[model samples]
Target: MGAAQETRTFVVWDYLVFAGMLLSSAAIGLYYACRRTGPQTQKDFLMGGQKMTAVPVALSLTSSFMSAITILGIPTEIYRFGAIFTMYGFSYVIMVVVTSEVFLPVFYKLGITSTYEYLELRFNRFIRLCGTFLFILQTILYIGVVIYAPALALNQATGFNLWGTIIATGVICTFYSSMGGFKAVVWIHVFQVGIKIAGFLSVIIQGTVVQGGITNILNDSYHGGRLNFWDFNPNPLQRYTFWTIIIGGSITWLTIYGINPAQVQRYNACKNRFQAKLSLYINLIGCWAILTFTTLCGLVLYSRYHDCDPWTAKKISAPDQLMPYLVMDILQDFPGLPGLFVACVYSATLSTVSASVNALAAVTISDIVRPYCPSLSEKTLYWLCKVTSWLFGAICIGMAAVASLMGALLQMVLTIFGVIGGPLLGLFSLGILVPFANSVGAFVGLTTGFAIALWVGIGAQLYPPLPERSLALSLNTDGCNLTSFHLKGNWTTTKGTFSPNAFQDHSAERTALMDNWYSLSFLYFSTVGMLVTIFVGIIVSLLTGGRKQSIDGRFLLTKEDFLSNFDYFKKENHISNQQLDMIEDGEAKTSELSQPITLSTQSV
Candidate 1:
């Protein structure tokens, strides 16, 4: 038997108990899907009858916000930077205040199903389609990451194959989400998040109480250098800095809460404008709480195993696996504790999966399928939403299995999301702020923004790293070892390592330029990408000039967007077709001879 199997840390009882809990929750999800009735229209299917309460909605938001990333990625940030990651946690408050004040009201008033629909209203159809497509793509990529991390943990714990775990998780999620629709997803999310929080918090409390109180954790952390603060370097290459956090993080926050389709679906779920905004803040608060436990747990784990060589653990081939690896070591004496922690990882992952399934279904149905088939019935829409959810789930599973060949899962996911999502933010901003930005200018701005972002994202990868640093620090091997992947001896078998002979092959080999330039610098991926996007977009917008007619102040309800909602504004006034017509309304004469579209006389 494999050493993982031989170790058998979890007893039969533990397996049975955990299985029961998971199955029961799954049963609840199935029930919700089976019983779901009434309106399955775009509003209800995507938004949850538009009567969802603030609390569950908030919880659901938090649940979606956290994925395998929150559980595994943050600790890594702490492990890499010590206490500096605290900056990331506190950044949430800033995200909430700014997001609540600037963007919510416009979204609420516009009655948008997909956030990018506003881009179409503000910009041209190409930008709208571009923004919507990227949102879907980014969300799918993130969902794949969410699935991959948990599957990795389970693979290590149960001696299961990693690919098998990925497929299993994807299939199970698809079954429920495909059948249950949004109702199934939200209910499951509520429960899954609740379990995740309880399990994570309990683990933290136990680790703290057992390890001589929270002070010990802090003291250990301080000595270990996890509490690092203030990287005052003005270099743009640095990854974390006050400026980057405020600017880039704020942009990310805006993309998520202000314009991302995932949160939009949640807002659309609420019955009232107040409830929708209520849920937004409530979610911010919940994320605040999640950060607390996850951070504490991270410190505790690090303090306990500060002396351990994480890289040496055969199971710790990836930095993200350290949490689960530590959980195994931490619970060596307590039979069920490992199970509990594993359960927590599963819960967080599942909540994320359910939420993604829900969001993707909404986007696929409302943005893609609905536009094509306006005559489809509610029941038909319901089935289509469910089917699309399953389709997306399958895509995510396939991507998760292939993620191994990509860049670091964490950095790759964020960079892709940032590059694509950054333009969407510009689109939303233009929609609400630039009254004179006709579809032409909007389109020009959007194309320029995206082209700029694309250049930074793709071009940056091709750019040679610091040529000087390549000579200073480099590692090369003539051959591979059977350590990280192959388990030659047993679970107890020592992990594989680079043989000393490998370096003999090329001690003089030049290092990659990335190693030279990639450090705690401000010139990171997001930094370069954001600057390119905003700069190009603004310039393009200016050069293209303005439009006729003043946009209504009511439509640009910056702060009021969220504080109030479009739901109470009456159905007829939902879209400003008449108001929009007032500007281009008279362009009939100009467009009469120019029916061919080209940033001129758009949709008159």
Candidate 2:
């Protein structure tokens, strides 16, 4: 009991270290997320004026991917499950390809202010709202989980109160998000990404040195039955086979690259079609490199501490805490390592939290509010953003608590997002792929893809894994498998020999199978969603007599139904500029000119 408690304990300095870093991050992020700038229009908040350079974009990719759960949860995966989980790094290939071929071109072409507007343009208002609602809801879950993970880590390590951690993090994130908007979010993303990778790579090297050498670590992992790389089994239930990789891998990439809120927000930030493509291409290398680096840490953990026996030690009830625990285990001898790790995790959270709040602010203000409150002013919109950011922050913290109590971290992550993301992707795909599919047909296809994904995802979760599988999938829902080495403590850690499990024990429960054939791969989820949407959309169009929207080539905007709204900002700008010019020139202005009023500023 004493040893177990000691293993999970923390120091006062650890608490202070974590708190100080977080406070600094919040201050910096707030400074960036909400700073006042030129025009202060809705487009600036929603898409950062589509003028972001590759540096911030690259960091944004890093920050978005390496959240608390990802930082800690992924290493835990490698510790318990072996090589299958490491395959996640390869997903960048799919991301780059899909972003290039499918999503970026359309989003850049449309110039959409609300990514969801395409849903309305392609399908109808219901599907558009549904898609937007799901994006917001799932993003909340994602942010919440991302928020909860580092807090959980700190709580376990230093005995900081969990609720305190939650609220503290939430309040600070809200402060920055309410102030800086997208520009702040993007700059902080750059900072967070740099710190996170430096911290991550440092541990990979240190952990390797601490556990004997890299060679010893490799030997232990290989000898412990964790080094196998192939699962040639043909069964669909075999979670990590080559076929699952091809089919499921494709789907995972599609949702993230094509439709997920995090990626879409970034995609819409590109200044041009080529830049969007270039950013994704840059993101691909970074994605693959970061994932591979993190995955290697997993392998290294498997090699060195195979003796510690994470499950038997009961350091955590689930695999999510493995990485944090592993860090603490090593940090027992080293000062500042844990602090650095915590800082890195916080960095990852910063990227996601700020991005999420900004995205929600944009969507709520642009899609839902703009449609209704057509007369909203910039001053009113900014205040609305403050209120909206605070509200979303509260909701996300609650969702994070729920995620902490439920299934495997990965499973919880996917289940919360999968049922809806596919359809959202499809709806967007329909607008781009099928020019003739009108609003009504798009709406139908969106619903159909969602329903199909839900049914399929549920089924995959409940299905059992075959005895020996091949490849690890990118799909959600606790995808990894753990095979314990020390059943009754028979295997000698010194000699590195192990006994096999009894094959006759077929009656015993073997695997935790959940429904949702992991479409975590890059192409499958979006591809299927797209195929279903295009097919259903065309059919619905034929049935309902829908037609191509008539607009001139010059009026065609990638992200917005800009033909109408283009006239609005342009017209308003012309009038406002003319009015300002006359006032500066000391000439009498016409009665038609609206007054130039100062925008009120409030500190959150």
Candidate 3:
């Protein structure tokens, strides 16, 4: 409120809370590290000896998927755009079904350490290598973004150095993951999930109390058009339509949760196949719950600054800073609450980076290195895993630093993911759905898909065409009562509305290729990439002397997984018919013995 309050520094209590989180995380690592006798081999290091419990694995999956970016970006998106992005909650239903029934079953049954290993089983080592390379690249590129999200926000909110925050978070996470291995990664996630929930709940509860109540928050948000998300538009360029969010979000999540090793590695670590599926459900539910809470926070933010946009007032430099700005505004007098919020952000970042480092290490060891050195000693392999983990952590830190200079590079890399993801995901889908698909077809599809995706992804990025924006929500701070909330600040709200397209003219010129490729919404990137991969793959498979015989039945999805009763009946009826035929043949032989045999003897 005042200058002194504005320049408030984190007190001892604040540092204590933050230090406690770091210590606990490091403690977990130390505990697991001391248990060298427990998981002494590569399998144990990567998959926790395949004896992990369902609940912890579930929590790990949820936390890993909801990175710092998602935690900060979701609320910022909803605040800037509208609540339409909340439809991602509904998209989880489709994601859960596909992963559980289709992807998880195949991967679990195969008992593979890396998701890319399934590519080798279904296709060849080359395809497996390609998939692994793409995965590692995507994860590495993404970790930078994840680390930067919190560091950037913290820098703007509190005078903490951005690079210092990034390095500290990255190094701490890497140490835990490298030493503690898979167990540490999962358990740390469990702890991090708790922190994330507390942070979200605190903001939600405090904001509601400050803004009169839930009833007023909803009324204000509704009138301001911040609560809208029911558009059924089929347009691909439309960002948050039901079709785009459900279809696109489903595909995006499928790649992240279903095929991505960061997630599937947890599935393999579970005690059994059923436990893995249960964890999937748990993760889905947790994801929905977190999104709902965060979305509510977004609405409250809109209510708080309805008339005074943070960007317009220069109260905050970026939308991501709004969360921290809100925290300091409301809880500056409360001492350690601000620190808890930063810890929450850091917790999310740690969970994500740790899981990624562990996963990348697992893939590097199991998919890439181990295959080349099959006879390596177990102890050597275990150490190699740890080394790989640290290597990736260091690489991620470097990438985070580079990300600042390469602004749109993150968007470009993410676009490349859709280009790479569709084919990668489709390769797995082909293995599950199309029995006639051979290794050659899968390989061809993967390469072709990657090439097409690269062309489109890169072309679009180079062209830099702007797509139509989603619906706009107007904000008004005219009804805001700051004094009643016991706050006095130099900052005040402006009544003018913010327009996303204010700078771009509607009649601006566009290149043909830009409209065709660059203008394509990122939401549909994965879906299109997937379709191209499958189409090219199937056609190539057919053209190249298609599969002559059936491959492994386990690789294919069937009625048995979904319709147990139908499979049972089909097996029973087939067995019964075979028995009846045998009986009839025996009866015919007996009849010949009685009469027809006598005639045959006379003829002989």
Candidate 4:
């Protein structure tokens, strides 16, 4: 066993910290469940009565966006691939603007529950059901990785039983989320996000202080090529370029903010459109802060063990284990600190899983169950919502148990997002932006996108090439006085490398379409899928006798949505009256052709 496993133990104070986390979450749930004003109806329970302020909702949105996979996986990413992942923070600005200006107004103004409902309005029931099915698949895959990530990390840090931790966290999150509904989920999120930030900052501070200082950490990481950020390569097969992280990542975030039920639910929970918009900006800031802190944690971990590569030396079993190992290494002597770190991981898991459960429940109730059982009472619908939430939560737990074989949590989550999320995002984009896209086009486009995404996602995983990394900083124990930091006598750095046969494989065909497609960087999955869907959707719609009448201008974010905001530019440019009238007339045609297809109008 490695030192990490040999020395792993949890103290009473650590358990107490974890207990406090669980109890407080349950207490909040119980409190909300008891309030007569709270969760009395389906809308109240699912939508938080539509009275939430910007701050709590913003925090909740932030927590949901950055799950345990991020908390654990990002640091590992930085440690392994350098700080290129940090570029994702830049995409938040694009996400906020697109969502607020384009998507939020549409969802908020329309007063819809499930965002997929908009699909039905713009297209047909087939498209709506397709969108909802994609969302369910995306959330289930994501939440499983989210729950399993921290549990796996905690097991590494404290020697806790992995299955027990997964069950405990999943059951606790499900109970609170089901009982208390959105309000309970939001408040608990606020609390957990606070702990998460504090826990991360503490790690960075302690790690930096111990590693001489921030300057020393940066210098060491810089020398090791771990500070690498810019990659101008336009090749789609190459990972972590500026374009992929920014452009591709923007599409990824748009999927989360624009159409995701978890986020759209928060948008509706707010007091009005303005507050909903405000929460997005707040969430953007939160994303920036968390990414910066975790990036620093990665740098500091590299600095502390500059000469001692954990994975190469077998000091840590996996890259995902890096953060947990770093915490135990640095804070294990300080009794409660290790527990606090474990609690931080759990906090991330709970917030993400709870949010997903709530969102999944909302989608299942609104999109699937209600459509089939129109005669059910609102009260009965509310009970059904809880049952569905619990059911999905249980399924998520089962998925998590199976996630151990999925490799690294972060890569797995992102790949899932690319495969499943892209299609759903394409469906929404088709509805909101393309006025000519019909339901048949959307259904065909979405199916094609999903097929391509899954093929590449699974194929690349099965044939994963050895990931290229720079280990320019060689290992030594000059900074270590502790004997445990030394490599085992039996361990040989050149054990595998010494054999010439290790490099003998040459079966790959570089020119094959399958090879080229599968070789495309994981970051490009969503972007490629989205573009393919849009292109296919447009072609199919036009080829199959597209909409003769314009879609309702309200359903789509046409020029009218932003024309008013850009009045100064239009006026300064001296735009002609004929041009403006043509734009206005087109907008009017949309309103003439479009009709609302809300839940009230549709059969249950």
Candidate 5:
């Protein structure tokens, strides 16, 4: 065991493989930087000249949100909780469908840069500013989590310096994102996603072979209670049940795919509406593929250590470290494979952070900065955009240092999204779907929803659910060879300490109001905030004499637009290729205008 531990440290081959990925990413940024024909315009820098195709954009969409959080956290979630985590795949399918049908058409037709621009068109500047603030907050905090997750995992498994990895990731991502702009970010996503998949596959294929085969893995997991797919418990307080996984998961992801600025920017960059929609469908496949791979990787981890659970055996301190530890434990004999997996994890980080940085720059320029400084030159605005990317990168690095103190990367991220993203999603949905939603309603609804959600989220964090409520499956340490591991006196190993029925007897002891509030599953935070916002926004609007002013039909998704999107083969109903060209051309000609021109009155 000691000899094997010695061999697990990163070697020269590992460093080389990791460095190669960084250099390749940097080179792609440089290529895009040098390839510019002249002074880059706002459209070129922020929108990729509105000429991006379906496939790379689709891949970029996939990579943008697939961050190290999913790579590291999802597997650990399954390992500890059960296979019920895989139920999120159904949520992804729902998210993509709602995004394509409901949200995409309104944004696509308006031909805008920042998505918050729609809020202003539909309501008022105050609403736009509020929406912009929420998005920026949500993204910056989420980037902090993304940057911190893999660094902590690698630090635990390989003795890598944690702060050093965080700084390196932030700096490299900032450099390329600031230099190459949106084109560079999208292409870098395309490049890194391949490496990310390769890294995931290496572990899955190698581990599956080592664990006998798929059947053996399934059998082992099934017997151990890890294959818990049919948990139909209706209690919202219970985590990972079918209702929470499907309903809560769908709303949580919709905040990202449907309304988040990071994703909306990607849709705005496509060549046309059809390609944008196609990119989303392709992204659906990519998301499901990665979800399956990570879920299987969790099962593989269980099969390898089912008899001697690492957390129970004191091999690692936290669940997030399991994947990295497994990689080092099993792949050490294969020289560069461990390094490839590390590269893969960081690749996910780079893709996510770069996309956030780029999206941040766009919103700062379009939503916040430009509205006040409409007279700023195009040249000045372009430079400001790049500088904003750098500024946000620095902020994310500082926040990453803070994220180390937060517990459980996956829940922390989703909680951040729910607390902020839910209200933003509600605000947008209210505007796009409700014709009578006024500025007063928008402002009051957003603030009230945000306050309540923050209270619930913070309360839940301060007083986490009891261990008995969200019990881990049974684990055994009987197979552990204590003689091979130097143990601390305080560390004790027990069999069957955690099981399905172990904690049920203690559930009735908690009855306080705050305790009940805190016990609500983290999955429902988004739903809570969103429902409050929509319900409150409607009530406020009706009370305030809703919508006294006329609204542009282009800003709302009406019945005709909703039904026409389903008529897939209707040539006239779709945005014609010629019309798309005109829209792009009009955007270029009107680039200097304070507000973008509404090119076509027709629905996308």
Candidate 6:
């Protein structure tokens, strides 16, 4: 093990390449900071003065949530399970269609800073607060996972200190995010996506070459059962069936692309509605490209290790480290290539962490702080936003310590998103899609849905499905030379074996219904939570006298509106010219009435 690890150690050129990536990122932040002319307003700091273009915003949107999870976890998932995970590309298509047609128009018309502000406009402040709190919790948890993922990869590959990598990532991300705000984050995303793509391409190109050809890789995967994609099983308990991947995957991406503040803020930052819609469409293509790259990486990994299973052979500690291990194994002879891949992983981490930090700052100021301290000055709020970014960075770094204990990077991230994001998605959907949903129903439904989803998610984590239930593809270590390898004492390769005693013998105490509920696949967590929230919300609303007050048409998107042309700025079938005029007048009034809190020099 020591000799094999020594072969992959980072040399001088490798360190130079890695350092160059970090310095370039920090320099971008500094460049943006130097461009600031005076005390920045919330619009400038948080919204990029609403002058962002389509392509950059689209790239930023892609990189924001894709993060280290997609870079590392998706490939790992594909390797462990099969290519059925590639069905997620279809979900991205569904997500973009729904987001562009339904959610974007309402949000663009309303011109809100924080996505949760729409909750207050449509429901009440309490619901808005609930939505805000859920977003904060979800983002912080997700960012922790993102920060920890590449740290684990680097630690496994090059023996970098795990906590040290986490701290370095958090500090660098915080520096740019707090200093330059939204503009810096978006521009850095554009930069990082290039590096990420390069890194992924390197792995695929080299792996394919090493395997003789793409056809050979495909043939190996097909024979090894890693080319699976045709499972049409309707069982929700099945981890990666066709039904779960499409339906469950759609809802999962919807929560992120549709209503999540981190995403919505990018749309809101666009120059106009056209640019915003264009960005989402462009993001769809970018997402598909990324999914394809990562999925191919998995197939390549499978092809390379078809005979000598790394995990079974004890070449790596965890599945997430597979990509890094492959990179080190194949690219060691190429100077600076390993460091470039490391930069690629950290680049993903930076884009995601910076975006989350900026979004967290935006929401804190718009949803939490501004509501209570409406009198705070713009200059004060600007500095406050910076401080909040730094604070959240620290909190997320601390949360990274806890994320290490979570089972797998991909599953844990999706679980966090489903448990928290599903109900939040439902809350937003109830307000926009269901016109009659009242504040009472919205609050009750969100809370209840969250509680139940958390319970099921936790239960699923605690009592995982049996080995046979997951139906993992077979692996073999027959080709491995066991004599030269020094295996860890605790590592055991138990294949195709199950003991009734593996789990506590509580079958008699647990009912079948309870067992099925707890054993449901993680993919369906979002669908279950979303359906529960919408169903319960509607029922509760009707029971308590639904929609007593007349709601602004702007807050609601009817079926006709959803089907109509996407031109929202003009008078259309959905919103009349009079209503459009009212919206414009309201915007003007809001601008005129808005005032920054001020004090006399003496008071200061």
Tens-digit per-residue lDDT, 392-432, candidate 2: 87888788766554445554455545556667666666666
Candidate numbers, best TM-score first, in rank order: 5, 6, 4, 3, 1, 2
Model 6 clash pairs?
A: none
After superposing candidate 1 on the true structure, give the runs of residues whose Cα lies further than 4 Å from its correct spot: 1-9, 37-39, 312-315, 454-531, 549-555, 558-604
The 10 consecutive residues of candidate 4 with the worst lDDT sum are 494-503
Which candidate gets the maximum lDDT versus the true structure? 5
Q: Give the TM-score of candidate 4.
A: 0.88
Local lDDT at 601 for model 3:
12
Local lDDT at 562 for model 3: 55
State the lDDT of candidate 4 residue by residue for 233-261, as single tens digits.
77766667788889888988788888898
lDDT of each: 0.61, 0.60, 0.73, 0.76, 0.82, 0.82
* Candidate 6, residue 488: lDDT: 21
Model 5 quality (TM-score)? 0.91
Ranking of predictions according to lDDT: 5, 6, 4, 3, 1, 2
- Give the local distance difference test score of model 4: 0.76
lDDT of 1 by residue, 1-604 (tens): 1222324345665566456546756787689766765565656666665556678878878887877677776765566556555565556777676665567656655556666655655555566677767778788777776777666655655554667667767777777767665666777778778667766876677778777898998997888766665555455545566655656666666667777777777765665555666777888778878777767877887676565534444434655666766665555466666666666776677777777777777777766676667689888987787778878888888777555443444455566666777766776666676555555555655566666666655543434334232111111221113212322123333222111111122334434533343322222444444445555555655666654455645546543344433322423244344533432322222112112111221441
Runs in model 2 with CA error above 4 Å?
Answer: 1-8, 33-39, 232-234, 458-534, 546-604
Clash counts for all predictions: 25, 57, 4, 2, 0, 0
Judged by lDDT against the true structure, how good is candidate 5?
Answer: 0.82
lDDT, candidate 1, residue 497? 17
Between candidates 1 and 3, the one scoring higher on TM-score is 3
Q: How would you encode candidate 3's per-residue C-alpha lDDT over 104-153 as one tens digit per residue?
A: 76676556788877777666788788889888888887887778766876
Better of 1 and 3 by lDDT: 3
